[model samples]
Target: MIDYTSPIQTTFELQRRSLEQSQQALEQSVDIGQQISESLLAGLDSQEQFQRRLVELNRDTVASALDAIESLPGADVAVDDLRENIDDGYERLLDGHEEAFDNISAELEDGTDSYDDLTAELLETVEEQLDLLVEAHEELEAQSVEAVDELAGQVEELQDQAEDVQAQIEQVSEDAARAVEA
Candidate 1:
């Protein structure tokens, strides 16, 4: 006799394997996203550090120039002019530094926001897929139970029919024996 449950069992196994693969892929995607975010933050931190070092170097150079100007003999007017120029340069440098800092701050904030949005979207997609898988599994389970119940009923009917056929065969054998004796 053919095993009727084999096909159903194979189908369920295939679906289970597919679901496992999908879950693994989702996990990998989340890991990759986290790595990318970490890399971006690290790069931003390095850039900020470089900018600070550059500002410090520029300040030291300005101070050194002012000391050199002060040491020169018979150059009072030149010293005054040099001081004014240094003041103006320092002011401009500070303003530029502030502007660059603001721009970087805004860019970093925007990057963080974008990362958060992407993460939220990915999570939502994963949740939806999981829900669908769960629904499919529940439906399959219900169908399997219904099929088994139907098969059981058919088996019971076949057993009753076999018993009736056996009774008829016994009656015929008894009649033949009586005829022979007569």
Candidate 2:
């Protein structure tokens, strides 16, 4: 008996692997963007204008990443449900940052000696967040790059196998035609 399931099974397996790899790559890219934002924020020296701009850019990037993930072909479920959480988190974080900036501005206008302390605290917080962001960004960048390379190799392999199979089929068909004419 012919093993009729082999070819279809192989094709399905390839497709499934491709999908998994693609999803992983997408997630990794988002993580890298988040990290970059954090690192950039950390480097700022407590300048109010700098902080405000960083916050805006980070929030926008996070929102865009969430949107991309949400629109994936098979994003119905996730390991951490990160897609849903990310958008809301970015929005809240941005709002909080803005509010903090406003408070700092008010303090500056009130001729209080508290601006130094407040700036110090804000700088510390930014530093901590930036450290985390940098780490996450590096890790994600490696993962995404590896995943993409692996997926490309797998696709090339699958294409070669398909072409081989096609050639065999054509050769068999030609032989059959020759035999029929004899």
Candidate 3:
């Protein structure tokens, strides 16, 4: 009456589902790695734009400084002021680029660390599932042993009943022979 197939099916489904989930997690990790790599390589900062802006500013300052100096030879204060402003702007531009590079580097490092952590967590989860599977297998083996023991007991009982029936037949034959003789 016990449909033993049910437990086998249940175990099989559990294993199947666990494997599926593990596979999905692996794929997701791979995707995350790819995205991170792309993001790192894509140059996600305004450093290049800032450099271009600095170049334009320097060109404009040089043109204006030259014009001011050429216009008045006696006194040219605008040229010196323009040069100083241009130098300051260039220094600030360099500093901004350095800061941008540092920021981007830090972001990439953080992303890499996070990816590693995610992968490690996924692997740990899979390991835990495998451990559970091993425990389930051991439990099934124990149940099988119990079932075999029960079957053996039933077989032994059947054998004893067969022997008792054979003895009763032999005794009935002996009684019939005695009756015929009487």
Regions of candidate 2 where Cα sits further than 4 Å from its true position: 1-112
lDDT of 2 by residue, 84-179 (tens): 577677678778877886775555444333433454465566556655765665566556656666776777888899999999999999999999
> How well does each candidate superpose onto the true structure, as a TM-score?
0.63, 0.38, 0.49
Ranking by TM-score: 1, 3, 2
- Computed on alpha carbons, the lDDT of every model, listed in order, comes to 0.77, 0.64, 0.72
**Cα lDDT of model 1 by residue, 37-133, tens digit:** 7777677768767876787688778777767877878666787887788778877987887688778767876886787788778778877887798
Best model per TM-score: 1
- Per-residue error (Å), model 1, residue 163: 12
How far out, in Å, is residue 132 in model 1? 3.0
- TM accuracy, model 2: 0.38
lDDT for position 171 in model 3: 92
* Cα distance off (Å), candidate 1, residue 159: 11
Question: For every model in order, what is the number of clashing pairs?
Answer: 0, 0, 0
The residue-by-residue lDDT of candidate 3 on 1-182, one tens digit each, is 34454575577668767766877777687777867766764555455566667776776777676777758875567676776777787778778877877787778777877877787787778768877886787687567757866776777788889988989999999999999999
